[model samples]
Target: MADQSSEEAARLHKFVDPVSYLSAFVSNGVRPDGRSCSTARNVTLNIGSISTANGSAMVKLGQTCVLAAVKMELSNPPLECPSRGYLVCNIDQSSSSLSEALSGPPTSEAQSLSQTLQDLLSRFVDCDDLILVESKLCWTVYVDVVCLCNSGNVWDACVLASTVALINTQVPAVNTDVELPLVSISSRRSLKLGTVPLAATFTIFKDKYCLLDPSREEELICDGTVSVIYFEDGGIAQITHAGKPLSSERLISMCKDGQTHTQTLYKLLNTVCT
Candidate 1:
């Protein structure tokens, strides 16, 4: 009898108005995933998973899995920024990643996500560190992010993977002498990344409730969302809100809540990366 009732409820949830269905759960101070409104899902980080790449990591935010790999390529520096290299970031999501079986070209959402990640990483990474010979040549760091599974809150998982992959990266040493710079694969050096950058996402339900690390189902029914990126140096890399309007006090509170998660991420990275 209990199993039958549970199955009927699940069916109703799928076909009924998602917001109304979700409201029933939220009113009780819990989400369908059994997490409280303010609680985020567990995050797991594994580094150096891809041996072929310069650096790599796999991060899972609950069930969402994202893999990030870094590759170093030598190229001429940009004319305007002659001393700095490039940090290229890309996000690739396949049919397996989504609940819906999407095929063919990359979706606009994926492109937008890639651009957002690129912007954030570019701001966090000191490109000058990649300089091999000032204006002449420099190492271009390519960060490729692939989504294996997107249960929910994939954005946070991607950020974690990208940052951790870069943390694990070791650039090859270049001998600047002679006609052309000679690269020594045997000699490599790790990047000097100061403070780690991390992000947290929240979904606003109704006008008052804020749900942290929302799952796919919750996101579908959310009224609005807030994404916070913390630099860990008393600075925010980015804060974006979508869906609905949020008040100043609520936004500030959400930012503070996000910071705590970011700090936790930094500590977790330190433990695994070191």
Candidate 2:
């Protein structure tokens, strides 16, 4: 396949000469894929792909693709936050991924990625918006993410998919005016999303070349990775970093780049949803 050949070539290119591979970015002001340091990949959001799920979406960020499905279930509220609902995110990446870095069972890296993603997304989406019966009954939105391709920037893809799927989710309306221990359910209803969140990911190569939406090959050779989330109004929600430490200046630069990416993705998702 052309994709396989490209990955193979990228791997061989990096393997043969790490210095040259990294230098290509600094000297050329572009990556092997011909993208600028702060340019994100093309992102496409597809909604209602899974008919069985209450809501589902697939996001293709370049070669990285992730599927997110939202399942709504009426359940008792947590004692701590009885008045608010919650979103649970679980990510499952199969062992047979596209690259060597991801071709394995659920590793600690994957688990940590899942947790961090859930945490980042949690701040963007408000569970309080899903409350139907305040203290007694609230909807729990289970966001299940599956990574179908691992070209790179899976975090952004997952977030994009989850957000779009949630916006498309339709929660049935419930009538609490019925007799004791009985509730009437209206099967046809939809949730009104309060805020839309957009995300952008960056990978720092050798602590100098900060590439946006790095491919799997780029990630393997990169020093570290960071992802930033922004609300629809362009306000930042969360910033996550891993691998080589980043300086304050670098963090600020990444945030600035994230703003531009946020606007682009916001427009893209809005267009799709509309």
Candidate 3:
């Protein structure tokens, strides 16, 4: 049985070579999906889908689907970082969707992706904005992301979902001093956020062609990927790259493209929210 499995794996590896070649050809200004190198797949954002969450959103980027839920709870600050309110992001890939060959807890890939998002969000959200009191209890927002489908570009999809969820979330006001505390929510209140940050991912193939928002097949063949996080105020919050390093010229071009794409995504989110 082991021998047969090994043979099958070898055959699969050999079969992938031709597909990689075809992907390389498409990366150079053409694609099997009939999209240009800089084009993004269709994006859809649905808000308030989860009843249990204070704020929730479902985002679809092409075939990739992510559901993010935000829950607000009163809690003391972390021992290490007590000055600011807590913001926790947990990302989990659905085992049902992932291949059996990739079994485990979140691999390094998922870990890095989560951290990148955390960094980008930290830059845009002022933790002080969530503070209802000084040293007492404050609202700690918890964001949970579940990737239902992995068609590619999961990072970008997750970012979009988080941003929309945050915008739609409403925190309940608490009267801590009263004997009969009132936990009433003012729906008209909006969270004080600084700016919205968007993320765009680009894949490099054949060390020459740059593909944006790659599909799962393309991701399997690519040499490297770069995910750039752009803030609305024309600032870059984070840049995460995996695999071989890309040239500075390519990096600059990708950043420029990401900036333009980010604006479009922001507008789309605004339209959906309104």
Global lDDT of each candidate: 0.87, 0.80, 0.81
Clashes of each: 0, 1, 0
- In the predicted model 3, the residue pairs found to clash are none
Please give the lDDT score at residue 160 for candidate 2.
85
Lowest-lDDT window of 10 residues in candidate 2?
179-188
lDDT of 3 by residue, 74-100 (tens): 777665656678888888887754563
Clashes of 2: 1
By descending TM-score, how would the candidates be arranged?
1, 3, 2
What 10-residue stretch in candidate 1 is worst by lDDT? 191-200
Query: Which residue segments of model 3 deviate by more than 4 Å?
Result: 1-24, 79-83, 100-104, 179-181, 186-188
Tell me the tens digit of each residue's lDDT in model 1 across 10-124: 8787678788777888899888778888788898999999999999999988888999999999999999999999989989898998857489888888899999999888866
TM-score of 3: 0.86
Tens-place lDDT digits, model 2, residues 38-96: 88888788999998888999989888889999888878888898889877888888665
Q: Best candidate per TM-score, number?
A: 1
